[model samples]
Structure formats: C-alpha cells, structure tokens
Target: MKNKKPKKVFMNGAIPPEKIANSIANHQSKTSIGAHSIFLGQIRADEIEGKTVQAIGYSAYEEMAEKVFHEIREAAFSKFDMTCAHIYHSLGTVKTGEICLFVFTSSAHRKIAIEACNWLVEEIKAKVPVFGKEILEDETHQWKVNK
Candidate 1:
C-alpha cells in the first residue's frame, strides 16, 4: 500500500505578513481563479464601557486552534468551488489597530470568494483557541473574549 500524507494546516504562533501574502499568491497559481476576496481583522483602540483599550494582546491555544482552522478550510472547500484559501491568525501578541487575522479565498467568481472569506473569518473568531487582552491606555489591562 502507498503511504498517505497527513493533512497540512497553515498555522503559526506568530504570523508574518509576507508569508501570508506569499501563500495566497502561490495558492492562486494552482487554479485559474477569476477573483479573490480577502478579509482582515484589525485591532482597535476603544473604550470597553469606560476604560480605553490602548492595545490588544492575542494568545492562542494552538492545538485546538489548528483543529478549528483545518475544519473551517475543509468546510469552505466543500461548500464552494474555491480554488484555494489561506488563513493566518496571530498567536502571541497583536497590538490595537493592527491586523490579527487574515482570510483569503479565491474562486472562479467573486461572489463565492466574498462569501467564503466572510464565513472563514467568523469561524476563526468563534471557534479558534485565541484570546485577547485589552490593554487600557492608562496601562491597565483585562482579558476580552469576542462575543
């Protein structure tokens, strides 16, 4: 019998922008997609109630996060005729007003790309093992879970 290859999920503790972009561009070459849609999650400095959030620190439980990410990729592929997808989420720390998650999906049509991109991002936020610490401008902080 032939050996089987294990499924690979593009996951990392700290994601770099160049690598993410490279992955997307490389994945795109595999299929002649007519359109690609991308959604990025960025940090925001805002008050939660009355305390101002100066920055955010992101941490993830990687084992579970990988599982969730793989599942989302599979679902997107099965649900749409997508050429490919690339998802990267910050694991260590992400400051406010900076990108923390990026989802890029490509398909033969723009609609599918747009829909899939949106779906994947929501899934990551809800299902992945990532947590956020909202830092107040005064230097105090608190943990925040996206609801």
Candidate 2:
C-alpha cells in the first residue's frame, strides 16, 4: 500500500477567492479529472435578538482538527474515485460574506466529486472541535454552534 501523507488544512483567516481560483487553475493540467465540486462556507451576517453578527472569530484545537481532516480525506478517497481533494478552514476572524471553509474535490465523474465534497463538509462540521465566537455589530459576542 502506498503511504498517504497528511495535508495542511488550516488557514490563518478568511479564505481568499484568489486561492480558490489558483486551485482550479492548478488542476487544469490533470486531464484525467473530469469534474470538480467545491463547497465554500461563508460567515453570515445573521441577526440574533437585536444584534447583527459582523464576523466570526474562529479557533480550533489544531492538532485534533488536522487529524480529523486527514481522516475525512482518507475516507473520501477510499469511498470515491477522487483525483484530488483539499480542505481548508479558517483559524481566526472571518467577516460576513467572507469564506471560512473551502472543500474542493475532483474526480473522473461528477457523482464522485459531488458526493465526496458533501461528505467532507458534513464530516468536518460534525467531527472537528472548532469553536466560533460570533462578533455582533454592537461589539458583543456569543458562541456559535453548527446547526
């Protein structure tokens, strides 16, 4: 069996659109891949009570999160014929409309790409011990939980 190396899945802040574009551009040369599915999780400017959320200050138990991410990656590869996969999650403040999570999966067919993308996202949300502090416009904050 070939040894699979772990990938770096954490970014310091909000994910840039340029990074997503570059990732797509980088895969153009891999002719075997026919489909790509991308999932971007954006911070919402949600109103709670009377305050509007302006940003989310994210933090994580880095080591454990990375391990879970790697496990999810491996599971996706085993369950699907994926050509490549990348998972990135924010580690700090991500403002409203900015991306906090990015999951990119490519495969020879659309089904594999799409399924793997969704699976990785659900797994990450359910398993990762990442915390978020929702920063309201009033400068107050509240803990964010995935729903």
Candidate 3:
C-alpha cells in the first residue's frame, strides 16, 4: 500500500506487466493483507468477419479516466474489505497479444479480493473513457467498443 497518497496517477501510458507485478508485490505486504487477486489483460490477434486484428491503439480522456478510476477504487473499498487497489491501462499503440489493462485488489481474505478484482475491472471498462482502435492485418482499422 502507499505510505502516502500517490502524488501522480499510477499509469497513464503503456503498461508493463513486470512494472505492475512488481508494484503489486511491493505495495501490499504481510501486515497489510493476506491475499491479493490480480487480473492481467492481454491483447489478442483475432480474425473478425474475415479481418485479422494486428494491433490496437488505446486512448483515454485522462481527467475523466482518473476520476472514474478513483471513484471505482473508493467504491470497492467501501463495499468490500479490500486493503488496496491498483489499476493500469495502456496508452498509445499496443500490438496484438499485448496487455491493455491490469487490475489488482488486495484484502484480508480470498473471497473479497476475488470479487473486488472482478468488480473493479468491469467498473473500469464501463466507466472509463478509454477508446481502442483495432488495426487489421490488411492495415484497415475500426474502433472497439463494449458490446
């Protein structure tokens, strides 16, 4: 957990799994929690209606994304006995099979942490103003949206 409130946002650019993993492992300690549930997101190359996705470009409204994320974190904390929460999302271009989002929630017990992790992801996806552009193998592109 943070010894002090994070002065700046955790991540607002390309997300590195190692950095996120290390941060989670470092942030939550024995005295702070008993369990940590992590959700790692990876980009996938897939064919959609005969078009293969080659890459994705992620963009976010920083102010809005940050505000929504903070609210989601606070809500999770109030609804569950979570110790802490960390969220990371990619910015700029991300190629196929690369992660665009990572969320980890810690608690004193397994069940709460698991549920919080799930909830946090959905909340971020629904509430954040993050846009994605799917670049096809043929170099064509389309925008991605929640279905």
Candidate 4:
C-alpha cells in the first residue's frame, strides 16, 4: 500500500552522513526487500571563469515542490514493484563536498530498485521547483543550472 502521509522532503542544510547511515540501518529489518539503490548529490567545488564555487544556497517553492514530489512518488509506486522510497533535499546552504540530495529506493529485486532510483532523480531534476545559487569563493553568486 502506498504511504498516504506526506513526507517531509526538505532539510535545512546539508544532509548529515549519520542521517544517511541511520536510514540504511532502519531498513535492515525489512527482510522482504532484496535490494536497495541510493543516490547522493554532493556540491562540487567547480571553477568557472576563474571563480571557484564554495557552496550552493538552495531554495524552492515549498508547497509546489512538495506536491510535485508526491506525484513523483505516486508515479514510481505505480510503475515499479518497489518496496519503499525516500527522498530528501537540502533547503539552505550546502558547502562543497557536502551532500545536498539523498534518494533511496528498495524492491524485492535489484533491477526494480535501481530503475526506480534513477527515474526519481531524473524526475526531480526535470520537474521540481528547487533552485540553487552557486556561491563563489569571493562571495559572488550565480544561479545554478542542473546539468
């Protein structure tokens, strides 16, 4: 059955490593899940035009983003034979080398888990209202474009 409760998808800042670890640990008891797929998005210190990116300040239309997230989850459940899925994204500043997004999907088999995780990432990139401002080392910023 699909989880009817709305998930809290946005975090205040960078996602902590411990949180990710705990998530994985929490699923150990679900013996029915044979495989799991995870995707982690980290901020990179990219040098653009002699400016080095130091961090990314994320923002979004929360209500709209939440609604879209729900739609994506529903679609995934309908399309794949997944056991469960979870998505968490940063809302504020996330420094270089820090995690900004975490996507986890599980299923009875490997293929379904992998496919669902990939599809969720793509759908989020294509549809979510989240925006990021790339902050350079000099404190200058530019709007980020997901590639």
Candidate 5:
C-alpha cells in the first residue's frame, strides 16, 4: 500500500552516519526484502576559479519541494517492483565530506532495487527545487549548478 502521509524529507545540516546505520538496522526484520540499494551524496571541496569550496548551504521552496518529492515517490512505487523507498536531503550548511542526500530502496530482487534507487536520484536532481550556495574557503559564495 502506498503511504499517503506527507513525508518530511529535509534534514538540518549534514546527515549523520548513525542515522544511516539505524535505518538499515530497522529494516532487518523485513524478511521479504531480498536486496537493498543505497545512495549517499557527499559534499565535495571543489576548487572554482582559485577558490576552494568549504561547504554548501542549501535552501528550498519547502512546500513545493515536498509536493514534488511525493510525486517522485509515487512514480517510483508505480514504476518499480520495490518494497520500500526512503529519501532524505540536507538543508542548511553541509561541509565537505559530509552526507547531504540519502536514497534507499529495497525490493525482492537486486536489479529492481538498484534501478529504482538510481531513478530516484536522477529524478530528484532534475525535478526538486533545492538550491545550494557553495561557500568558499575564503567565505565568498557562489550558486551551485547541478551537473
């Protein structure tokens, strides 16, 4: 059954590793799930025009983004034979090497889980209205471009 409740998809700052481990541990009792796929998006310290990025400060139109996230989840459930899917993205400042996004999908088979996870990531990158400002080491900022 599709969950109709509005999911809160944004987290403040970076996603902690403990949260990831706890999520996996929570699913252990679901015996029917034969495979799981996970995606973690980490902040990178990229050098742009002689400046090195120190962190990314994220912001979004929350209402619209939540609605879009719901649509993406629904689309994934309908398009794939998946058992469950969860998405979490960071808000505010996330430093380099910190996790900013987490995508998790599980299914009875490996291929389905993998494909659904990949598709979710792509959809989010293309459709979500999340914006990031790259904070340089010197504290100057530039708008991030999704590539």
Candidate 6:
C-alpha cells in the first residue's frame, strides 16, 4: 500500500500562506518530483442582494469527511502517477480573502500533477459533506452552494 492511513484534513481556522510555502520547501529533498500543482480556495466576499459576505463558518461530520477524503486520495493515487498529495480545509470561521482549502499534488510530469489536483478538488467538492455558512456583513448568513 502506498498510503498507510487517512490524513487529517481539517484545520482550526484559515489556511496560512506560510504553511503552503513550507510545504513546497519541505519537498526540496524529493528530487524525483518534477512538477507540483497547488489549488487554494479562498473565501470570496460576494455581494448577495445588498449585503457582502464577511466570512465563512465551516462545519462537517468529521468522521465521514475524513473517510471520504481518504477515499479521494486513494482514487487519485490509483488514477495518476503522483509522488505525493496533501489536502487541507478550514474548520471554523474563515474571513474574506483568507484561504479555506488547499490541495497540493506532485508528480514526475506536469499533466499528472495538474490533473490529480483538479480531480481531487472536484471529488472533494462533490462527495465530501462539508457545509459552509456564508456570513454576511449585516450578521445574517446563507448556506454556500458549491458551483
């Protein structure tokens, strides 16, 4: 088995840029990786009606979310020749312009890395049961719809 266990994907708040940089820096030792694809999902301040979004309050069924994430990883590995993959998502409130999701994939070639990263994001969005509350500026909120 290439993967041993399911990795924890949930972070306490927003995903930090430093963490993303360190992830790339850490892979310097892996000389076999020729390409890396990264996807960062940031909270957008979309104006709905007259109010603008301030932040997103995210929640999920942890047990099932982790399982689904692991399944997605396994499927990606089987489908693409990836060297390593990592995924992280925010759990509490993430303000506008902050990152809530990060997906990284590395491979010997560019296409595989890019394809795996995109595929993982799509699968996670479609399959994982993570819910997001779009908090508006007026203190009202609405459920986020992944489009």
State which candidate, 1 or 2, has the greater TM-score: 2
The root-mean-square deviation over C-alpha atoms between each candidate and the true structure, in angstroms, is 3.7, 1.2, 2.7, 0.8, 0.7, 0.8
Q: Candidates' lDDT values, in order?
A: 0.73, 0.93, 0.78, 0.96, 0.96, 0.96
Compared with the true structure, what per-residue lDDT tens digits does model 5 show for residues 39-61?
A: 99999999999999999999999
As for model 5, its CA RMSD to the true structure in angstroms is 0.7
Q: For model 5, give the 10-residue run with minimal summed lDDT.
A: 1-10
Better of 3 and 5 by lDDT: 5
Write model 3 residue lDDT over 15-102, tens digit each, in one string. Answer: 7767876976686455768888998777788788898898888877777777777777777877888887787788888888777788
lDDT of 1 by residue, 15-110 (tens): 457766786668646667898898877778777778787677776666776777787788878888888777777755666766777788888899
- Weakest lDDT window of 10 consecutive positions for candidate 3: 1-10
Worst 10 residues of 6 by lDDT: 1-10
User: What CA RMSD would candidate 3 show?
Assistant: 2.7
List clashing residue pairs in candidate 4: none
Give the residue spans of candidate 2 off by over 4 A. none
Model 1's TM-score against the true structure: 0.81
User: What lDDT tens digits, residue by residue, belong to model 2 across residues 24-138?
Assistant: 9999999999999999999999999989999999998899888888888898888888999999999999999999999999999999999999999998989888999999999
Mark the regions of model 6 whose C-alpha exceeds 4 Å error after superposition. Answer: 1-3
Prediction-by-prediction clash tally = 1, 0, 2, 0, 0, 0
TM-score of each: 0.81, 0.97, 0.87, 0.98, 0.98, 0.98
Residue-by-residue lDDT tens digits, candidate 4, 84-128: 999999999999999999999999999999999999999999999
